[model samples]
Target chain A: MIRPANIPRLLLTPAILTTVVTLGVCLVVLLVLSFGRQNYLDIELGLSAHNFELALTKPLILKLMGKSALIATGVTALSLILAYPIAYLIAFDIHKNKLLWLILFTLPCWISYLLRILSWKLILGYQGVVNSSLMGLGLVDQPIDALLYNSNSVVIALTHAWAPFAILPIYVSLEKIDRALMKASGDLGDPPYRTFLRVVLPLSLPGVSAAFVLIFIPTFGDYVTPHLLGGPTGFMVGNFIAMQFGASNNWPLGAAVALVSMLTATLLVCLFIAGSKRAVRAIG
Target chain B: MKNGLERWLVEELECGRIDRRRLLKMMGAAGVGMAATTWSASALAENNLTILSWSGYDIPEMAPAYFDAHPAPDFTLMGSDEEGFQKVHAGFRPDLGHHTSFIVGKYRDAGLLKPIDRSRLTHIDDFFPELEQIVTTDGKLWEAPLSWGNSSVIYRRDQVEVTDSSWGLLWDERYKGRIASRDSLEGLLIVGGLYTGAADPWEMTDAELEKAKDALIAQKPLLRFYWSSQTDLEQAFANGEIVAAYGWNASVAMLRKQGIDMALMKCKEGIVTWTDGLVMMSGGSASDDLAYEFINAYMSPEVGAFLINSYGYGSGNAKAYESVTDDRLAELGITDPDVVISTSKFQREISAETRQRYQAVFDEVKLS
Candidate 1:
């Protein structure tokens, strides 16, 4: 009665059930809560779109959402630009001790995320390493006040925090590419750059897209980085959502803002995937 | 009994006398037995008192007498009063909870709190009458006053020259990009109202709210960052990253300890004062006797002295001042509690609608 194929299905049953029970149930609860009304500290559950309407129409919320998306996109673009080179190096050039190279590259991930972010604060603070070094070298008479506590500082910290996550996927896809394709392109009289552009880069699009989505989604909802480094102007949608749940005591609005952010991020990610697919096809 | 059984199972597993699976099974059986015992002994609910408090307030020093009478109560730390209030409103059944006076009305209105009997508090006479008055409504006391403090502009005296000790020093152009404001709705809006000369900072009109919002937006550029924690503000001051900031009494005492020459300004407008205390939950599983014992222990002069001397906060117990030295009191800037209270404006309770408007203005300023 117990076949091997059925055994695999049975083995997968727990994971499937877990996903449904946890993620699926949570999403449904959040959806319901988003439409409810906030009565003092308690949420009066009912059918209403007032929260969503305010989330969408409020100038402050809309502006913060836009700013969060822009910051996330900038972080994604920067991570890709920075990660691709390192990933390419590890995939193609580091034939000796490739595992060692990989471990070295991801060594920062071993530290706590909070510690890593705090270290960036130390490196970028007014009396931080960068400013001290600059001032010591006579690069400037005053410490650069703009070095920390802004959107750029937030972008820098996030790009560092998610570097390993971005690098690994791109590296995996690059490693999976067949060397013969590059040889074929070169054999057909294509230059090295052409081979890289047409064959290698297009083929590695999956990893690149994976890396993009991985960083973009979390970065969009990042509260700590922006809260710590993103001075006054760097407050994001996540902070706004947190304020609603905390000081504002408006769970319905917080839920609605959160759902709206998720939907907007999903739409952008879809558009990105579609655009990347087009680029891949055109290049190939 | 549970601990003994668990230790025995661990030892047996380590000596290879029992497999891990068998040890786990035995442990599970022991846990079930423990649960059964707890359920059967539910009449002795005082033994199961649960306390929800701010992080450091749950230490044994805060309630020595209670500890002597019973085992350590279950302690759950909350980061803020808002967080604690939300947890209780969402059906958390802790016997005792900590909250600020400003939010006590909200808790009372929500029917989450029980009226505290004054006759039950042994240390009631030691408490400042002014503070007790703040937490009382309709001749019923709702919370036992614990710690009180002032929120004011703290500045590095050597680094910045101030002609006037006013809240305007926070928005001074001379300290451009070298100042920090509090990242709090109540703190920020109150600062805005006071600076803009609103009649009542806590109950500003629509136009007053707008004026405060505009004033905050203009001051945003001059801020290095809005500090949410006392530690961050202290670190910034220590590093010379900021010369002025809106801070609490703890920061003033802390920075002075580090030899930062920090001064807590006696602002011309008024300093913001706040008090936080312990309240009994209405439907808590624990017995009222246990809750009263814990509140009394926390309010004792010894515990009050510990709070003031250790944390640089004003203890609600007036007699606690006798234990603290006059010099230490001066260093903490609470030389006379009556004078401080008279000169300072209390952060009072506001309606939900007013709170929303204030929050909106604060959020709008931050986002802008």
Candidate 2:
């Protein structure tokens, strides 16, 4: 039998190794393809930065990437706000069977991601649940057409889709908090709000930070939600990438776009990590 | 009843005694596949005849008699010609695939397709002359013509007063926040070409392209969304969110069924039309004989009648119209093949550089 200390690392090795090998090869291939000239079926092997130049120099691509960043930022912020209360309730108010609450919270995740998004589509459609209810109640004469197929709908779906991810991390951080600190703060004649502000909030920053990163990165590259829900106005950089690879058959340009987006994501993640670490250290 | 001539021809071809040209010429004169297919009805040992085709083409309604005649081919539906091209290029070889005539040259050059044996197709002579001309290159046929249709402007009859059926209607400022457009660059460039009054919408000059891009960019704010699917377009139209958009004949047909008060416009600049059909893939496990059986089955007048009676697309086989009533043809807005061929701008293959530029320009308009 393996020692308890080594068990975590042992279990993690295969997953890590698999990801590294597969992703490493993919990244290498993508890089090579990005520099080659694309001629329909024939990709000539001369080194060229034309595709990169094409991808980066486009003012529209930059604008779309900016829109994607803004949308991802909104999703992260909304997820954090919506998830905090649930995580807090589960960690503090629900004294027993916390695992049950976590499961219930994660039940939406057990279903396929596509199905869940589709359900949201049905809900937010023109003659959807909300519009029908409003019409049935005699509050509106016609079904509201603005509920679905826009950037707002995209954000709403993404926030709902990623909320569980936010909840788990926040719950873990909140659960790991020492009870003695809260009691000690209360014993010093500090009110509950002040105690939470001083101790609980600062302690949960790591989890909040983790949850933000977890939601932000994937949401930035999300094309499916936008393509289905966002309509034209909601299209992001990811959809552009998909178009290049799929319909345009421009693998070189697609790879370049992917590389540029990855670099942008990496830079943002690093900055977030550094900033969050400093915030945690200063608070402690 | 198998004729002695057909038996001799089949045996001679099997024994490698004749060239494809001689066979085609003989078949063209005598109607070979039809005569042979009538007699050759036994099942082959092979189990699969894989087909990669459009979504509606795979449906039983399009080819009802085909399923009863032979074992069902594994159907993988394709959304776009480019997607089908890329899939086949990446080595996803189905026995037969649906592709546009414009890309036939590219696919043939890539060696992704084998030359279709016209002698094996019973309905080759039944195809319209316009379709026959498109499918043939250097007197060698590459694909079997299946269906032809127009890319038209679909608008609400109740809301929009579109008197002049022109591509310029999409750019109108009155329909701001009520326009739904396609995200496809090829489709957009076609519209752009029409807007700029270019004779050939598929091949635009740099100046014409600039004008197209400018016009699209100007119209960007008016669009509610750029739709990627039929479902997206239908919902938008149904809810009165979008009053006008570009769509195919099938989508318009579906929308009218839902009582959406939709009408397909016959643009003054002539609508952009695409002709797509089945081409034999180069590599497959199925024997040439079995593949020919499947092709011949699909080419029958019964299958042609099914295609016209169900979908709004024009059947490739001219004789299929013999089974369709005048009322049905009137309902579908098809006068005849000559009229559709004359009034529509059929797409030609654009150069790679032109395609790339169009993609870039469209991306600009969409993002801007």
Candidate 3:
């Protein structure tokens, strides 16, 4: 810092400028709408928290917000759980063909995500292939209605959607670990499990945190999954906000809802960073 | 085990964010919803008229023949009625909008429309008198009638036994969880009102609506799915997810055209009828002459018949069937327009309190 140069600032200027422009546009628009009086059918400007009040008060709105949070959280946790083992195996166990396997694991990322979700519906609907196969095999005489348009289906679809996102980060973190540390832990009379707990797990926290933040943020505001497979009963807050702006014409309320979710996510990310810092300090 | 992993690998191979949207719908409704918000003033000297409508409803094939003869007018497509309402309030200007009759009163009250000039509309009398009366307030016509269809039983005659014309099959235990319905609060609420024998679905008493809601809730267990699109509903029928689902007159012919064997039963609980009417916006009244001209020309028997063949709904012009062959009329089940109207009530506008109550019931019904 004492020798800070003009070149470094210039090098960073483009990235900082891009982020500022992107966030500035969004921030100004959302801030403007959040404080206005934009109702479903009419726009009468007033200085009131009517939009925020509606966000806080409406049972339907709050319920959808809660559902969005829960779905996002569940998707993140499940993705981490499912991806960790594969990521670990790819990074540590399959050193001979690691790149080939990694490439293979990421192939689904190339296809459209919406197409994959639609495929699940094709397999889960009443006359879907899975239902017919189940009936044909006499597993049960009836198609399982629960297999479609519920929290369970959303979780399955979202977890599948977010699996790759979780895997790559954990793999990167795991790959970056020092081999000497693992050998040292093993030489200290620790078992493989202890070595993993003492060496690998703590180092992977950064990647896990990154995965959680990345998956949680997008899933928190996902609009299509619930619409396509979630059905009318599968209402989510994102869907409500979408309707508010789209069909209901309530811009202020939608903006208010969006702002609240963003604030919540910001608090969580900060808390995660702070806690991770404290944990490192305590370990030292 | 490898097969399961391979499928999962194939299914979810991407270790990255993958989100592909099916519908190219814009993210927010703020712009689209406000698309109909009336303008503060009209630059009146202009002769052009802007019509707000469903995309398919504005198809030149279904539009007035003279529209092609004259310079084509401007159009804005709305996603739904709610969106149309929002767009108008947000100052998205349109010269005309074809909304259900229920909204005419609110539109007029909100000063969003101009009274129809019947003298300028040559084929105004061609519309069923019932529609004229239904869309009127205090002996003044607000919007000109366009077309009408009933929310009746559309089922596969080949699959389900058609024992009754009532809405009973919507909750038949034999077909539990294999039925489908439209995903509208009004469609379900009004249909429930009729199912419980309410005198008028549009004006059902609160207690009666609660009962109607319970009936809908009972049907939830019987529903295969609730559809918001032709693609979903069409797929449901093709895949046999639904046996006797709520369908449009359009769907009946479309399904038949796709070679999907199905039938539209004249459900005995009569039919829950809805109508669309063209209203002149307040700001666009300067172009009212063009609007009225289009309206009249759009209601010609040939235009009306073309609409029937195109959209599966009958046009308001009573003589429209005369321009069509018996096979075409038979294909549409339009031997008599008056008879169909008699079996229906024009969905009337309700107070917001009443709409919210019905919506609440609709939510309960879905979760139930």
Query: Per-prediction TM-score, please?
Result: 0.89, 0.86, 0.79
What DockQ values do the models have? 0.62, 0.35, 0.23
lDDT of each: 0.84, 0.79, 0.74
Model 3 C-alpha lDDT versus the unseen true structure: 0.74
In candidate 3, what are the lDDT values of residues B26-71, reduced to their tens digit?
Answer: 3124463232222212223544566778757666665556577666
DockQ of 1: 0.62
Number of the predicted model whose lDDT against the real structure is largest: 1
* Model 2 chain A weakest lDDT span, ten residues long: A275-284
lDDT of 2 by residue, A1-284 (tens): 88999999999999999998899889999999899887865777668999889777887778888889989989998999999999999999999999999999988889888898899878977678898899999999977767777889999999989998999999999999999999999999999987887799889988998998899999999999998788667889998898777666777888988999988877887788788778756754
Per-candidate chain B TM: 0.84, 0.82, 0.80
Candidate 2: residue A282 Cα off by (Å): 7.3
Report the C-alpha lDDT of model 1 over B1-368, residue by residue, as the tens digit. Answer: 55345344334533343443354456568776565455435534434677777767878998999888887877776655665666666556677888888888888888888999999989888777888888988999999998898888989999999999899998899999999988777778889999999999889999999999999999988999987666788899998999999887778777888998988888889888899889998866568988898899899999888888877889988888898999988877777977776666787888777887887787788866
Which of the numbered candidates is closest to the native, going by highest DockQ? 1
Query: Where does candidate 1 clash, by residue pair?
Result: none
* lDDT, model 1: 0.84
